[model samples]
Target: MQVAVINRSHHPLPAYQTEHAAGLDVRANLDAAVTLAPLERALIPTGLYLEIPPGYEAQVRPRSGLAYKHGIGIVNSPGTIDADYRGEVKVLLVNLSNEPFVVQDGERIAQLVFARHETVQWQQVAELSETGRGAGGYGSTGTR
Candidate 1:
């Protein structure tokens, strides 16, 4: 699947780190470092503009290493970039730890995963079909 993209950042285009990697690492495009205090969030730009296919979407997700090491994560996990969007790709980053997190220019902050999605049509049914565990949710099953 080929996607049309425009790169205006100093760093190279986002790419898969491994052969079997599902998401591509996206970098932060900034003139100077941006510090995020604990529990603070900021919208960091990537300087990337993409043209996704009609049946697909670009999912912006947090990097596991950053989350585990620095308590850095995306405010809106797995943010959806619609196919019709034609603006710069920005990430909503948040600091979950007590210390402030500094985001440097060209730093890998998020991962982009392109996924296929389906548009569903409402059937306007009278009732939904019954299941084995109907209406049972929120820890209905035991942890053990």
Candidate 2:
């Protein structure tokens, strides 16, 4: 899949340290000066604008290394980037640690994965067919 990206700043993106990496790493735009404290969350700008094709979306995800090492992660986890949106890619990060987290410019903040999604079509019916356990929800069956 091909995606259109715009670099608002001159800062280069962070490269993955290992080969055969699954996702492309994104960095924070240090010029924005975004910071967060323990149990706090902030929206950090990446300075990257994307143009995703129709029928597809870009999923903004957290890097495992950053989540594990810094005790920080994406608040929405896999944030959905709509194909029609033509805006700067920003990351909502939450610091779960006790210390304040400083997000420097050009720091690896997140990863983006492009995926295709199908548009849903709904149909209305007067009555639906019934099954043995029809309309059962939320542990209607025995736990054992």
Candidate 3:
């Protein structure tokens, strides 16, 4: 599961904080601090270019600590980086709190999770089989 990457920022490459961590922390590659007013969003660059393998994708996600502490999150949660994409990784960050938040250079702003995906082929069919909970969706089951 090796990926080809080019890092132009002064920050080190993204890495998992824990041994069993699923995602690697990605940093912001800014020369100076950028302030985000409440309810504002910005496109922050990572200065990382990756070459993901076919059938795989890089998922950019928000950090739980930042979300809980500062109400900072990704505008498009789990933003997908397609395998064919070869551009610098950028994160769409949003401030959900009522106060401003500052993003510093080389700050851990997001996480990247590499996952394998499948391509689907549509099959024309007349009818489909029935199940116990047929077509149940969107809170069909109780939270409990």
Candidate 4:
């Protein structure tokens, strides 16, 4: 689980925990500032780069405190970072509040979690087995 981080600005790299950690902290770029108006979206630089091994992916997620308090959240919640991508890690933030939102440097913008997955192959079939609740969606069952 080796990740390469690029310090674009003079700011130090954000701290990371490896032992039963809840989330990977993503910090805002101190060099570049961000301002998002109501319902506006902005691509925020994290001033970090990552190197993920094959068969694994880094999922970018929004912080609950930031989203609930400031009305700011990741535009693409749980954005996927492919294993083979050797690009800088960036976050897309959207301000859902009524007023403008200012993003300062070193601010905890989001959280990233690394997960491993397997690529499954799909097979064509003429007919599929039906289940008891086949095609039931969106609260179709009784909410007990």
Model 4 TM-score, all chains together:
0.88
Weakest ten-residue segment in model 2 by summed lDDT: 9-18
**Per-residue error (Å), model 4, residue 74:** 0.6
Q: Per-residue lDDT tens digits of candidate 3, residues 18-116?
A: 999999999999988999999999999999999999999999999999999999999999999999999899999999999999999999999999999
Winning candidate number (TM-score):
1
Cα lDDT of all candidates, in order? Answer: 0.97, 0.84, 0.96, 0.83
Backbone clashes, each candidate:
0, 1, 0, 0
Q: Which lDDT tens digits does candidate 2 get at residues 32-115? A: 666689999999887888888999988889988878888989999899999889988899999998888888888888988778
**Candidate 3: global Cα-lDDT?**
0.96
Give each model a TM-score. Answer: 0.97, 0.83, 0.95, 0.88
| lDDT agreement of model 4 with the native | 0.83
For model 4, the superposed segments whose C-alpha errors exceed 4 Å read 16-20, 30-32
Model 2 per-residue lDDT at 143: 54
Model 4, span 18-116: residue lDDT tens:
667667788887565778999999888876777788898989999888999999999888999998887778889999999899999888898888899
Count clashing residue pairs in model 2: 1
Q: Please, what are the lDDT tens digits per residue for candidate 1 over residues 1-144?
A: 999999999899999999999999999999999999999999999999999999999999999999999999999899999999999999999999999999999999999999999999879989999997788889986643
